[model samples]
Target: MPNSLNPLLQTHFDTALEHPNGIKKLRELILTLAMQGKLVSQDPNDQLASELLKEIQVEKARLLAEGKIKKSEALPAVKEEEKPFVIPKGWEWVRLGEVGEMQTGTTPETKDQSNYGKFIPFIGPGDIKNYKIEYNENGLSEKGLEKARLIKANSIMIVCIGGSIGKVALNDRDVSCNQQINTVTPYNSIFYHYIFYSVDSPYFQKTILQNAGGSATPIINKLKLSKIPIPLPPPAEQKRIVEKIDELMALCDELERLKKSKETKRKDLHQSIITQMLEADSQESFQKYFQFLTTHFHELYSVKENVKELRKAILQLAVMGKLVEQDPSDQPASELLKEIQAEKARLVEEGKVKKSEALQPIKEEEKPFVIPKGWEWVRLGEVLQKFGAGSTPLGGKSVYTTDGIMFLRSQNVWNDGLYLDDVARISKSIHEKMKGTKVIGNDILLNITGASIGRSTIFPLNFEEANVSQHVAILRTFTPSIVTYLHKLIISDFFQNLVFKEQVGVSREGLSMTKLSKFPLPLPPLAEQKRIVEKVDEFLALCDELEERIGKAEEKRGEILKGMVNDTYSRNCI
Candidate 1:
């Protein structure tokens, strides 16, 4: 391949390799090039499009004189300024109405049931798919056909109203459509395929769609649509162009099938590897799987969905004590639990936090997964200094202010962190009134109810203060250092499964404080907890970086495909 054309072809192929929609864009490029008279070389010996137009005009005049069609006012000539780009020699600029019989369709009155029956397919915007009319069972009776506009076979139908505007279809069988469609029956049968392809081009789509910007429901009348210009090629060239379009589209279909097949295998391989890592019971087996995964990280993490699955496995492994090794020198978690209890007692005595009901000791079978030698499992209630959800302020959202104290809701919390883009706010007085819900630095906020249930985040330490809504529970550890580790634990699949089961009520949607407190959580050594947090954060940060690269690749893929199409269209046209 020549140097200039080689890169375009490689980008085009790479686009299909990387993303599924790239093929769809490629199809658009094909249609655009076809319509621009650049898809096939011109044959000087072939009859010119201007001569074809003359024959089409003569056919239209004969049909009018034969009383087969009504004679309407003459269509205006195509102006030089109205033409979008220069056409090649032997091609001609022509108005859509100059060579076709245009008709707008209408629906019959719905109250008359007799007007509707299975007689002929009633084409609508929804019936148009990939440039062909899909024959839905919305047929009309003979009585309805009398009231409806008759559309001949091989007519190009286009939607002219609402969100489905600019949808076009070509029908081979006789059909009638609803009021939203306009059909053009070519005066000469030879022009049907080429005319359909022209109307289906991205250029035509843009021409009609540009008028739609400001309307609530976009619309273009039959007259305006008929006045649009078309670049007509000689009949032989038109045939060759259509043939090339079909061949290229078939290749696109093959590319899409192969891409999807390869993608499915990658996903299955990626997920199976992740599942094995999660299921491996022994340290040796887990290490084997982890090493294989790490060695092939680039291959496994190529797709965003694959990276997401890997993140889940990493989180589960972190909580299960499989991510890092245990050090014999670190303090055992049982010792730390005693200290947390002593701190909790001090808070209770200070009257700073309410003394909660005692939780049942975890039975041996209740443990979700085995922990390292230095770790112990404890009820979530045992380690917390405070636990409660807040109430919605009086008057609800009407009382919300532009800015004051940050009011955190379930929407603001995510597994990764707090997203305050749309966080609600309240006056300082309201924050003061809602003392039970006040949040501090390093506090773990958990969404306890509704669709956002189970999401948790650690409040930023640098921020002064914030408050929570009824759906979000404030989880303050007896020791502030445990906050980050606990937040990661709460978001892991191991803990989320507990949050979703056996709720306070039959709904199983709202997680009560009782259920949350009784939940079993693995407690690692203080130093080990820090290590686990660091390792987990590092893994998650890597996942984010991989996703960022994928996102940038996707953005570049789109820009390259679009630039290729636009550049090809511009260069081919002028």
Candidate 2:
């Protein structure tokens, strides 16, 4: 390898350690440099590639006379414009067919039982992975070999059809493959792996794909494949290039393995601490675990999966009344429930909202977990003034307008907030027709059906007027302050698990509002609910910030790897 690249290769880990796909890209860079004759220095004493070409031609002529391969039409001479870059003094640019005997494979008929299994390896595009051939158990019988093209050992195989067009591998065993693959057995046996690495280089892979035709499925026929340009170096330099590629690739593999190991260790550490924090019986133990995480969080939460776990832990603690301390001066949740019920009754009596049917009492066994002293268990429906789902307008999608009242669907509702970028709209007249489902400010919109069943968001307190589809429910509370806490509860894992159990989707049915009305809720004191929401908002914001910073850090790391690639291209190759 070039002496100058040694230092750059040494720093590969430092540049790529933080990048998710850094090592994989580094492997590609190594091969690209090798293809451009920048990987290893040239030796004047070695035989010229011009001499090697003459020897290859003589071997092809002898093989043609032996009838081992069919004679193909002469490929056009390489144009000076075809070479991507200038090569070293001992190197030459040649068409790939000039280096060896090339042939496209064919598959035997599957309907013929006589062509069943035997010892001839039946290779296909699926058998090649990561530049190596992984042998399959299925083999073709001797009769099958007669009907298919036979490739000898030490051949370079490449997929020339479909999405796998550029995939290449080296096979060390005699094989018969399907029509999707093409094989090249080099004239000189020493160039077997050298040829394999050459086809895998970025230059050749790009050429293969660009030449592929067919609008429906990409395909490069044997004639097109044979005409692809490739650089040929002296035999001695070829050996050196192959060795350098192997060494660098092994280093990349080690870096990837180390990164995965570090991430796995970090995942286990963060998951273990989160488990402890959630299961802590007393506040003191919980604080101890939380404190450890607070101090060592940077180390444990570097991976995004750990950040996800932290978010979940925050929601669980908030609902269980352990996120913030309660105050003695505040009204307990049971009294709060009574006041909410009185307000609900007043609304029903005034004919503002339909009188809700009596909900079944919460069973002791139905309670998922225990709450703090000031908290009370009640049905989710008990505190709401409006507890009904919306309905679609007269004409479903045909009545949509470019500008009118916002028509919300389940897709518009998300845990973060409503998304109106592609929201459907209806005329003002149609809005009046669907006034029964009219949406107002301070109302919580819940997705009662479809894939986003458990997601919800509170409408802006003072925003544009809108209407909702049948999939969304209006969950307006007697008190505005409780809506935020209720949103947190709906998104939590505890509530999500129970919500999924109520799905009736095989019949195109939604989760029944009756079942939702009976769903139990863990209600904390009014004062504590506010504090929990604040704390959760604070922590979740930190998570969002951390996630953003991680994404930016990864982007910077990617740029570092990209810098290496651009540098090699500019400095090493013309």
Candidate 3:
């Protein structure tokens, strides 16, 4: 290898080894080189591929004379315009059918019990994975084999139908395949591996897709498959290329193993750091590990999963009252709870809200975590003036209109805020009937059903009024001053974790109104709540910056890998 080429290959491999997609691209590059005759140097002493072509022709003629294989129609001669590239001096470009017998198989009648008793392996496209077929899951009887195309072991099979079209694999043993597979038996067995690598090349796959066109079910017929051009190298050069490919592919496997091992260690260390901060015995110990994280923010946040963990940790700390210090100067959370209770009692007496039955006292064992001083544990229903999910309008989706009152579904709610892109709507009369489910500005919406049960969002003041469906619930705080803090609490991991644990039902699990009403909420002093929200917003802004930086860094790395491949291939092809 040239000294200049070594660095390009190394840089490409080093940059992408950490990601699965990157390793895939690296494999594509390997196959690209092998197909282009760039993986191994050509030797002048080796016989020319044109001479090998004559020998392949002789073998084909002998097979035809012996009546072992059916004679295929002579394909059109290769035109100069059809050649994709200029090959080395000892190489030749020939139509694939010129050197191989390509045939499609069939399935026998399934109703005949006698056709199912034999032990002949029956292969399909799904049976082939990676580069070789290890075993066939189905079998055929002697009667079935009479109607099936029997391909010899080591022949190449390419899927010719549906989504698996162009998927090629080497048959390790003799088998009968379905109509979706096209088997290619080369005239010379020495060229089997060479042709297998060629058919698996990126160029061949692209050509196959181009021929498949835009049909509902893409397929490749025998004629189209045979017309695919092959760049044949001298017999000796093909052997050298295969050997080099095997050695380098083995190296790639080792590199992939090492990358995954290193990633596992990094994840373990990252989790340990988070655990240490969350389980700290004192504030001093917590800050020590947190400082280490801030100093190495770029290194730790490069992985998206790590950033998600950071986000979760921030939310957990906020709900635990550890995000901000307790203020002895401010009134305690017990006083706030008492004031909310008095307000709720007044509303029930005035007929403004419904009177509800008393809630069960929280047991000590049910408390998930300890709260800081000046904090109190209360059921979520205590602070809310109203709490209930909505109901779907009569006729459900049939009542929806293109332009009318907005209809909010579970999909409309996200962690940060409401998403209106896929929202539905109803007329003014329908909105009137849904008065109980109507939402207003500052109202928090929670998805209480199905896959997105824990998602919560606050409706913005500037948006038009809307009514939610059965999947969403509206939570109206008795005191409007703490709405933002309440919204944050709903989004916090502490609340979400509890919601998941208390969900009910079997077929389609849901968070029932009773369960949600009894959810334990950690109440901090009003003044401290404000401080905690501000601190969380500031830290979240920093996390957003880290995410943007990581995205750009990955984009730049991808561009470098792409440029290296394009530049190296362009220069080498000349």
Candidate 4:
């Protein structure tokens, strides 16, 4: 066996606390050690599994005579080549069928859902969770029970078919399962929990799955299952291994809880720091908090989630007019709004765009943040020439072609920009008929439905002519300077939260065109808007750098842990 202070194992144990893939890596190491016969030492005094097999054979004959179970054909002895690993002196590798009988439960052909009673809880694959059998109110009728096989308490159930193939559970209470499950009734007095843990091992799962049939839902027939090889340890050793595993697993659980607590504390601390910065009474207070954050940047901004939170905080600060000092010389947003109105009126008179309905004035309750001097809160509809969703071509396949007109879907619009690679193409004839829905360069695209409700992207100059899907809404800004600022506002956490709150639906919440037009926007002065966009972009780039570094560090840590586990197993086996 490996030494207690083996550097490799020590490294695995030490670093596993922080590695993201540590649990999976630890499980793999345990299986590797088990397969190498290094998990528990062999006891020479214990009876050999070969001798136990003889006793089982005699017991099987007795059961056959009593008509307790059906007799089956004798299985061939395990060949030397069939042995995958070396076993301890007293332990042996034997067919699973030698120690237990494997049988499948029945699925009723006809059953009324209304007839299901409370007492007889009918179990299905869904009833099994985390290696324990749970019962539901559904029950098998008398006729159904006749077809179904009754499984005794303590019997192990294995999901032999469907999506959950290889999942094993133990029935603490007598239960009946559907056709998809196989039940194993152990003849020996070995703890059923030990057997359950053994078969649930990743090694056993992989081996059993290899022989499973079917193209879609793989299944293990009774014949194939009975022939599966199982490693038998001394009954005392089985108990000891289970106890050791329990102790180690408790340690892992504690580590996980500690990690979660640490993350929660970090998130709380980040929010606290941001709150102090945002709520600073004066420039002096802001500088103090900012300096503290910058000094302990590595400690405060280690997690990717924290970096994303930081980006959102930056946007909140920018729109609230806290990012940069407000200049008294700059033009006020009220004057800028008048210019946008004049521009829209000119477009309407020129027959370039249709006039939108008047929106309600921003209410006192609707103001999310205090605006700086020269800034004004206004509806998004007041600043845009047109805000509406696109329409789909009704001709279906006839109107769609491999290469014709580019159709922009909701997915094409990302937070950063538009993605054009997978954009669908529509026929030129169809594009001509839908001329009003055409998207131009610098036009902002926003998702108005589903999970990506508030995502916005600017149309690139390269794709000047593109038709958007119904899910995407086009916003033609009346002023060029405000487009980037508006995009950033929509992408901000405060506005996104508002979108989610106002969204209407049971299954899929969505923002309608009517809602989009009326959504409140914090309008900064035209020059200030430009400055805010520039500063947000610069900070976002830094967030990206931090995220990339954290990801690489996590990956390196995982690799080190995996290497340690492998080295530990190798030394232990040798």
Question: How high a TM-score does candidate 3 get?
Answer: 0.94
Report the lDDT tens digits of candidate 2 across residue range 1-574. Answer: 2345656655765666677877776876888788778788889999999999999889889989999767878988899777777788989888988888898899889999678587688988988898888887787888988898889999889899888888998787888888999989898898877888889887788889889999999999988998998889999999999998888887677877888899988888888888888888999998999999999989987767888888988998899877887788888998888888888888879998888678888899999778888789999888787778999876679999999999999999999999988999999998998877888888988888877888889899788989999999998898787888998988888788878888677643677887888889999988889899999999999999999988888888888888776677566444
Candidate 1 Cα errors over 4 Å, as ranges: 1-11, 65-72, 130-132, 363-366, 500-509
Per-residue CA lDDT of model 3 for 1-574, tens digit only, reads 2253434466677667644467766767787778777778899999999999889889888998999888889888778777766677888888888878898978888888676644788888888777667574458888888878888977889998888888888887778888999989888998788888888877788788888854699988888989988889999999998887777778778777887887777677788888888777677888898888788776777777788888888878888876777778978999998889899899999999998888887778778888888998888888888799998999989999999999999998999877889999999999999899999888889999999998999888877979999999999988877788888888888898888878887544778888889988888989998998899888888778877877777787777666655665566553
Judge candidate 4 at residue 321 and give its lDDT: 84
* TM-score against truth, every candidate: 0.91, 0.91, 0.94, 0.89
**What is candidate 1's CA lDDT for residue 126?**
83
Candidate 1: give its CA RMSD in angstroms. Answer: 3.0
For 510-560, candidate 1 gives per-residue lDDT tens digits of 788877788899889999989998998898899999999998988988888
10 residues in a row with least lDDT, candidate 3: 1-10
| Regions more than 4 Å wrong, model 2 | 1-5, 107-121, 133-144, 214-217, 505-509
Please tell me which predicted candidate would have the highest lDDT against the true structure. 2
- Per residue, candidate 4 scores C-alpha lDDT tens digits across 177-226 of 87888878876646466567667776578778898999987998778877
User: Which has the better lDDT: candidate 2, or candidate 4?
Assistant: 2
Worst 10 residues of 4 by lDDT: 1-10
Instruction: Score each candidate by Cα lDDT.
Output: 0.84, 0.85, 0.83, 0.77
